[model samples]
Target: MKKNLKPTITASFLAIAISAIACQNNSGKTAQTDSLKQDTSKFLTQPLISNIYTADPSAHVFEGKIYIYPSHDIEAGTPENDNGDHFDMRDYRILSMDSVNGKVTDHGVALDIKDIPWAGRQLWAPDAAYKNGTYYLYFPVKDKNDVFRIGVATSKTPAGPFKAEPQPIKGSFSIDPAVFTDDDGTSYMYFGGIWGGQLQRWKDGKYDANGSKTDSQKEDEPALTAKIAKLSNDMLSFAEPVKDVIILDKEGKPLLTKDHDRRFFEGAWMHKYNGKYYFTYSTGDTHFLASAVSDNPYGPFTYQGTFMEPVQGWTTHHSIIEVKGKWYIFYHDTQLSGKTHLRNVKVTELTHNADGTIGLIKPLKK
Candidate 1:
C-alpha cells in the first residue's frame, strides 16, 4: 500500500535553512547547500536511477536482463492523510540493467493514467510477468468510484509501451499485486494491504468505505491476511475465488492481530528457493520486511523472521529475484527527496541459508 506518515525532512531544519539563506548574499552558497542536502553517500546501495523518483520496485529477470516495474512518483502537492492521497502517482516507468550495479536504463513512460479508460489516479506498486511470448504488467489503481482495483496491461516486448484492458480484472480490490509463476506453469497472484491499502475494507467481500484503519482490533482474533488467487492462463482474469494467505506460529496457530511486528501488512512477494515457497511482506507501520514459508502456493505458512530492518523512510516495499544463480532484492527508501512519497529504488545481494532461512539484511551500510 505505500503510505508513510513520517516526514523525512523535519520542520525545524527547514526553518533554520530558510533563515540562513535569507541572511546570505551569495546565491552560489545557497545552491551548494541544497546539493549537500540531497547527498546519498550514506545509502548502502545507491539508487538505480536519479533522473526521476520511483518506488515499490518489482524486479524480475526476463530474457537474461533485469527489468523493474515501479510507480513513477511526482510532487503533486496533495496533503498527506491516512487514505494516502499524497501519493498522487499518475504513471509507471520500467527500468532495466545488465548487472546488479550496472547502468540502468529508464524506458520512459510505459503506461499512463490517461491511457487506461477506467483508471482514476495513484498508480501504485506494480509487478511484471512473462508467458507465451507476451509480457504482463499487474498494477493497482483507484477507479472513478475511488475504490482500488487490480488492472492488467500487455506488451509484446519486455520494455513496453503496454496496452491496458478496458477495465480492471473482475473481483479485484485492494492493492499491491504480485504474480509468481511456478515451475509447473501455474501463476498465483498475491495481494491485499491493510491501512491505506484498503484490505481491511473488504472484510465481508464488499467494499466498506468506513472500514477499520488497521486490522482486526481484537488481540486474540486472527489478523487480517493478504489475499491470493490463481491467474487464468490468459493472465487477464482470476482463475478462482480470492483466498486468505494464513501465517502460523511455531505451534501452528494463526498470527494474531496483536502481533504487529510479524503480521502481514502490505507488499506481498513470493519466491521459490530450495523447493520451498517463501512468502515475504512489509510490516507497514512497524517498518520491517518479514517472511513465512509454505510447501504449497496457497499457504498455511509458518513465520520465519524479519529479513530486513527499517530503512530511512516510512513505507517499505520490495521484490526479490535470482539472476545467474545469484539472488538480489530491489527496494526503495526516501534517501533522494527526504520525503515519504518521493523515493528511489535500489538493489542489494540477498543470501539464503543452508537450512532454507533467509539471512537478516541491514539496509544501512554501517
Candidate 2:
C-alpha cells in the first residue's frame, strides 16, 4: 500500500549544492577545498527520499525486498546542544525498495509517539527483525522520566503499523538498539551510546541524573563499551544480564577514553561475514564509521580501522546488509536540508577485503 508521495528533487538538488559550499567553508581543509573546487556534484550521495527528512537508517531485507526503518527527522525548534535536544523526532515512516536503485516506497507513518503508552518524545534510531510470523520494531526513545529506554513494537507485516507494548523493555536503557539474529535462531541486541545517548549515566547500573557527557573522565581507563544481551524467546525483553561488548586494540588492551578515533561512541550494528562477527559503530564526535572483529557474537573484539569518512552531518549512524550477493551500507547526511537535525538517508555499496577487513567508504565521491 504505497502512497502517492511527490518527489522534491528540484529543491533538494539546490540544497545539496549549497550544503557542499557550507561544508567546505566550515571545514577549511585543503583536501575538502580541492575536492569542492573540482566537482561540487560529488559532495553528496543522492538521498533515498527527499519529500521528508530521515536519519539513522536501519536497513534489512525482508521477503526479497529491502525495508528500511529510520528515524523520522523533523524541524523541531528545540535548540541544538551537546545533549541532542534539537533532534525531536516523534514518529517513523518505513521505506521500501524492490531492488538496488529502484523505485522507493514511503509507507507513510508506520508508528507514532502518541500510540506508545510509555514513550515521552524524541523517537530515535530503530531496528527491525522478523520471526515466527511477526515483525518486531526495536526503537529507543525517552520515557516519562526523561531517560532513554528501548521499546519493541509488533506487526504482522514488515512494513508495519506496529503496535508498541504498554511499557518499555525492562532492563533496557540508552539508545540505538541493533538486534542481530544468529544462525542458531538466537537474537542478541547490541545497544548503548554516550553523550546525549545517556550510556555514561548508567555506569553504576543506576541512572544518575547528574553524569558527565563523556566516558571515563580518565583517558587511561577503559572506554565505556556498548552493551549486549540475549533477547528472550518471545523477543519482548532480555533473557540474561546485559554485558559490555569490550573492544581492544591489536595489543589486546582496552581502548582508552582519549582514543576518540577508535573508541565506541554510539550506533552499534552487528553482521556476520565469512564465519566471523563484525561489530561496527560510529565514533561520534570524531565522525567515523569504525569496526572490530570477534570470533563470537558476544565479543571482546579487536579494533579495526575506520571504514567510513565523515559526511555533512554531525551524527553518523548506519546499517550494513547483504542483498543477493552484494553488500551495501545505509546511512544519512545533512545534504537535503544543510541542517544537522534535518537529514536524508542514503545507501552505497560496501566491500570486504580478502583479508576480512572492510574497505574504507567515502560517502561523497572524490
Candidate 3:
C-alpha cells in the first residue's frame, strides 16, 4: 500500500499550498480596494470661499474640524506706485468647516499686520497647528527693516482673534513657516523660499544648518531647495538645527534648477502618511503645486512631479491634510479677482496611490 504513496502525498500538499496562496491574494486585493476607496459625497467644492481673495492656504485639524488660516490679499498697488510686484497682503483670516461636506464659515480676520510689532505690512504665507489644546499660528511678513521674518500668533480656540507675539522668531529670515508634530510628541518646523534658501528649525529655537540657505553662484540662481527642523516642546521656537532637504527626481537624482518646471519656489507644506514624509510646494514663475517624498521627515526627498497645475495663470500655493479618512489639498487661485496676486482659497479632494504617492490634481472650474 505504501509503495508509491510519497509522490501522492507531496502532490496533495502542493495543491493545498497553491489554493491558500490564491485565497490570500484575493483577500489582499479586497482589503486594498476598501482602504483606497473613498466617497465623493462628503467632499466640499473648490473655491472654499467666494467673496474674498485668500492665498497661501495652511490647514490644520483641531477638535474634529478643519481650520484654514490664509493670507487675505487686497488690491492696493497701482501702476504708479507698484514696483511691478503687486501681491499686497496685510492680514489673515480663519475659515473652518464642521463636517466633511459642511459649509465653510469665515471666522473673519484672526490677526492683523498692525498688531505684529516686528512685522511690516506685507503678511505673506501663514500656517497653523494645535498643541495641548492651544492653537499657534505662524506667519511670514516683511520686517520693519524690510527683511522677511516668521512670526507667531496664539489663540485659545481654533477660530481666533489671535494675538501676535511682539518679536519675530529670531534668526528666521524667510517666508512660509510650516509646523509639523510627530507621533512621539515632538514638533518640527520647515520653511524658506527663493535665492537658494530652504531651512528647518526645532521647536526649541535651534536651526538645522545641514539644510540651511546656501549662497548662489550662477547668474540665474537655482534656489528651489526646501528644508526642515525639529520643534521644541512649547512649539514656539526651534529645537534643532535646520536641514536643507533635497528633492530628487524619480531616478533618485536631484532635480537641480531654478525654473518652475523643475524646482520648488515658495509655499512649503509638510504632511506625513504611513510613516512617509511628503513635502509639497509651489513652483516659482509657473504656479504649479508640486511635491516630493522621503522616508524621514527631514529628507533628501525624491521629487514625485507636479500634482496640480496653475489656476488660470495665477501662482498656486497649497497644503495637504487628511480629515475623517478623506484626503484634501487646500490651494488658491485668482478666480474671484482675475488678477495674478489676488487669489481665492480653494479645496478639493486628493487621492494617493497604493504606494503612498499622490495623484495629479486637476483644478475644478466650479
Candidate 4:
C-alpha cells in the first residue's frame, strides 16, 4: 500500500518464510486429476536467502528454530517517501535462524530495537506462538499514533527481553499481524493490513482488549481475503468469526472483478494439512505472493493458487515455510536490468489437491 521502489542495498544475506484449506479447483490448478496430483516440485527455492533485509518475513518453528519475524527495512537512505518515507519506524527488529536441523548454519538477532517496549519508530508485521514455555510476539505499531496498535510481546527466550503484553489486542483496527496455533492447541489472531476491511480480533484468549466482541462489514471485504483467525485457549483473542469461524470465503467473493487496487490479501499466513486450513496470501500491485483457501481456521474461504507472480518486475511481500513435509513460498523480487524498485528475495514450491487446492510455481528465469 506504500509505493516507491529502487532497492539493491548491498547484502546482509539470509532469508526464507503459511497455510489453510478450502474447496477451490478454480482451474488455476490446471487440472491433472489424479486426485489433483501435486509433488510441488520439492518446494522450490529462491525465496530470498537475503536478497537484502528481506521485508515481510514471519515464519515459526519454536525450539526447532526457523523464527523470522520481519519488518526492518532500516530506512536505508531515508527518501522514496512511499508514505513510509524511507521506512524509519526505528527499523523494528527481530530476526533469527536455525532452519530445523540442517541448513541455516545458525543466524542471529532474536529480538531487536534493544529488546522492545514502546520500542519507538515502527516495527510492523510479526507473529509467533509457543505457549506455556512462552514466545508469543505479534506486532505492528507506529510506536504511538494515538496507538496504531497491534502488539503483544513476551518471551521465555526465542531471542530475549521481549515482554510487552500489558496491553493492545482487543477487537479493532489492525495491521499485518498473524498468529496461528492449531492442530488442537487452538489459538488464532489475524489482523487487517487494510485498504478497507478484513478485521477480526475477538481475542478469546484473554488480555481482554476491553472485553472483545467484533464483527465487521462494509460490503468490500475482499482485497483477496486472508486473515486466518481461530484462537480461543487464551492466545490473546479470536475464537470465532472468520465471518463465523473458518469455512472458506463464506461467500465473500471478489478477488477483484475490477482493480479496486489489485485485490491483495495484504500478507496473511496459516498452514494446516490433513485437517484443512491453508489461507496464504499476497497479491500483486507491487506484490507477488498470492494464495487463497479455507476449510475453516475461521473462514468460508476458497480461491486456491498463485503462490508467486511477476516473472521479473513485480514480485511482492510473502512468508511461508514448511520443512519436513515440504511446502515453501517465501517472496520478494526485481533485480535484473536492476531498478524497477530494487526489490530482492525469492522462493518457490507449493502444491496441493486431493481436495486440498493450491498449486503455485512461476518465476525462475531472470
Candidate 5:
C-alpha cells in the first residue's frame, strides 16, 4: 500500500537521485572521439560540385566543419529553376551548410520534423550528432506498409527546432536514420534502406539483441550477407546476438540464396579509418555505393570498393564528412535535367588511404 508520491512525483524521484549521484561522482562529459587518421594514401575524386538539394542527403563531421545536411522536402510538383516535379514533400527540414576551404553556406532549417508525433506527416532522413551540449537529429517516417520508422530530435544549436523522442522507435522495420559515435564513447543508430529490420537505442533506450538486424530474420539474427544494423550505447539501444554478414550481390556473394534488391544491403554506414572498421553499403537493382573492412566494429566484412553510381538519375545512400583536412561524400541525386524523380542532395570530394581505400568523388553542383 505505498501510493502517496505526488509533489511532482517526489520531485521527480529526488531529481533522479541527485542526477544519479552526480553521474557517479563526476565523469559525465566525453563524447567527441574518432579523430580520424590513418589511411595514408587513399584519395578519391568526382564531386567538386552537384545539386545541394535535388533530395534526401546526409553527412556529418561537426565542430571542425564539413556539415552537408539535406532532406528539405517541401515540394509542389517542384520547380525553382530548370526542372520541376519533386514528387511528394511538404516540410521535413535539415539543410545546414559549410563545405570546406572553398567556402559555402545555406544554413536553412537545420532540423525540423514539425514535432514528430508518429511522424505521420513525412519528415524523411536527417541524421546528425554532437552530443552533450546537444545537436542530435535522427529522422525517418511513413509508418504503415512501407512501414518506415525512426524518430529523434534534440537541439542545443546546429540551427534547429529539434526536440523529439517519446516513441517511434519500437522494434524497427525500416527507415533511413543514421548516427554513429565511436572511439569508445559509443552511440549508434544506422538505419535500414527500404522495409527490413534494425532497431536499437541501447544504453538506456534499450534493444541490442546483437544490435538489431532483419532481412527475413535468418534464424533470429546474424546472417546478414548485407541489409544492416549495429546500434547500442543507449543513443537509444542496440547490439547483442547480431554478428557479421555483409556480402554484396553477385560480386561479393550471398543475395541470401535468392529474392534480392529491396534488401541487399540498404544504407548501413560507419567510419573509423586507420585502426579499421569501414562498412559503407548499397548495391544492385540500382543504387551503387560500396565498401567493406572490419578490424571489429561488429563485422566480418572484407568486400571493399565502388564509391558511386546509383546512375545519373539516382544513386545509393551515402554520408561521410571530414573537413579541416578534406573529405566529403553526402549523396542522393535525381539528375534534374527537368527534375527526373524527386531525390536531391549532393556534396563530393571524399578520400581515404593510409591503407583503407576510397577515392574518386568530385560532385559539388548547386
Candidate 6:
C-alpha cells in the first residue's frame, strides 16, 4: 500500500511540473506577439526635442538637410530665489535632421543674446535663409533701451557659430523678423506686432519712398495687420514701400474690420508654392497658425483660415518649408513643461489641397 501511494505522489508531482513549464512557454510566446504588435502599430510622433524645452521653431532647408532654429526654454530662477514665471531664455540651438530615423543632432548654441553687444534680453523668434553663399539668421531681441529690435547674423554654414551684426537694424521696431526671397530674385522682410503695427518692404535696409505714413495713421486701428515688401540683393534693408497684406475674410474683406481672427501677432513665415504666395503667421493671442495667399507676395491676400490649432500653451510661433518634396510646418507647444512660457518645438507633415489651400494639421504626441 505504501509503495502504491509513493508512485501516485511521484506521478502527481511530474504532472504539476509539466503544466508549469508549458505555461511559461505560452507566456513567452504571448509577450513576443505583443512586442511585434507594438512595433508594427506606431503613430506619427512630434515635438522633435524632449530633453529640453524649445520654442519658436524656424525650419530651413539647407544643402539637402533640414535645419531647425529654436529658442531654448530653461528654468530661469531657482526655488530659493523665486522670480515669477522666469521665461528667461538667452540662447538659440540649431538642430538638424536628414531622415526619419528619430535621430536629431544638436549643433549646440548658435546665438546668444549676451553675445550681441547692443541687445539686452529675451532672444525670441528667429528665421534663417541662404543667399548667394551666406546663411543669414534673423532674430528679435530687446536692446539696452528696452526696445525690441531686429538683428541679423551671418554664417558660412547653416548650423553656425554665427557672427551677429554689430548692431540691430536701424528703424526696425517690434518683433518677429521673417525674411523671404521670391522667384524673381527679390527678397522681403515682414515684421511688427502689438500696438497696431505690421510693416514690411524690400530688404534693402531702407523704408518707404513715399514716406512711412501713407494714410492718416489712426491710434485705435487694429494691431494685428501684417505687411510685406520686396527685399534688396544684400537683404540688409527694405527695397520697396511697406504694404499692408493682412488676411482677408471669407467675404473678401480685411480681417481687421470684422474681427482680429486672422491678423498676425508675431512669427510671420513666407513660402511660395506653385506660383502662389503662401503667407503664414501666428495670429492674435499667439494661439493659431493662420495663412493667406495671392498671386503676388505682397497681397490682396485672401485669408485661408487656420491650418494649425493651438497646443497646450499660449504661443504658437512657426515656420513652413519644403524639403525633398515634403512640406513641414515647424511650430512649438507647451506639452513638455506644462507652463505657458516653457514651450517645446514640434514638426508635422503639412499638406496642401488641390485648390492651393493648406489642410488642417493634426498635432501628434510621440
For TM-score, the strongest prediction is: 2
Instruction: State the lDDT of candidate 2 residue by residue for 25-144, as single tens digits.
Output: 111211111222344477645776665677999999999999999998876678999889898988888888888767677777788899999999889999999889999999999999
Write model 3 residue lDDT over 1-366, tens digit each, in one string. 111111111112223223322111101220011101333223233345443567888888888887888887766653422122366567777777875446667666688788898876578888888888788999888777656678888999988889998888766766788888878777778888763222322224443444333323242653446667677777777777666768877886666564558687678888888888888888766777888888888787888878886665346778888988989888776554456666667677899888777887777433
Specify the highest-lDDT model's number: 2
Residue 83 CA displacement from its true place in model 6, Å: 16
Error of 6 at 237 (Å): 2.6
The sequence of per-residue lDDT tens digits that candidate 6 reaches over residues 1-366 is: 111111111112123223322111101220011111232123233345443467888887788777888877766652321111255567777777775324566666678777898998767778888898998888887778655678888999998868899988756765677888887677788876553122332234443433332121343454346556565677666677666665666787655522445666657888998999988887646478888898887787788888887666665788888877878887776654556666766677899999888998655333
Model 6: how far residue 55 lies from native, Å: 1.1
* Candidate 1 lDDT (Cα, 0 to 1): 0.83
**What is the C-alpha lDDT profile of model 1 across 1-366, one tens digit per residue?**
111111121112233234332211111111112223754456666666555677999999898888999987777878999778899888787878777777677666788889999998889999999999999999999999899999999999988879999999999999999999999999999999988888888866789888787684588899999999999999999999999999999799999888889999999999999889999999898999999999998988999999999998896899999999999999998775677887878888999988788999888766
On TM-score, who's better, 3 or 5? 3
Candidate 1 error regions (>4 Å): 1-41
- TM-score of model 4 vs. true structure: 0.29
Output the better candidate (4/6) by lDDT: 6
- The parts of candidate 2 lying over 4 Å away from their true place are 1-40
Clashes of each: 0, 0, 28, 52, 51, 13
* Order of candidate numbers by TM-score, starting with the best: 2, 1, 3, 6, 5, 4
lDDT measured at residue 94 in model 1 versus the true structure, 0 to 100:
81
Worst 10 residues of 4 by lDDT: 26-35
Q: Is candidate 3 or candidate 4 better by TM-score?
A: 3
Q: How close is every model to the real structure, measured as TM-score? A: 0.89, 0.90, 0.78, 0.29, 0.29, 0.76
- Predicted structure 2, TM vs. truth: 0.90
| lDDT value, candidate 2, whole model | 0.85
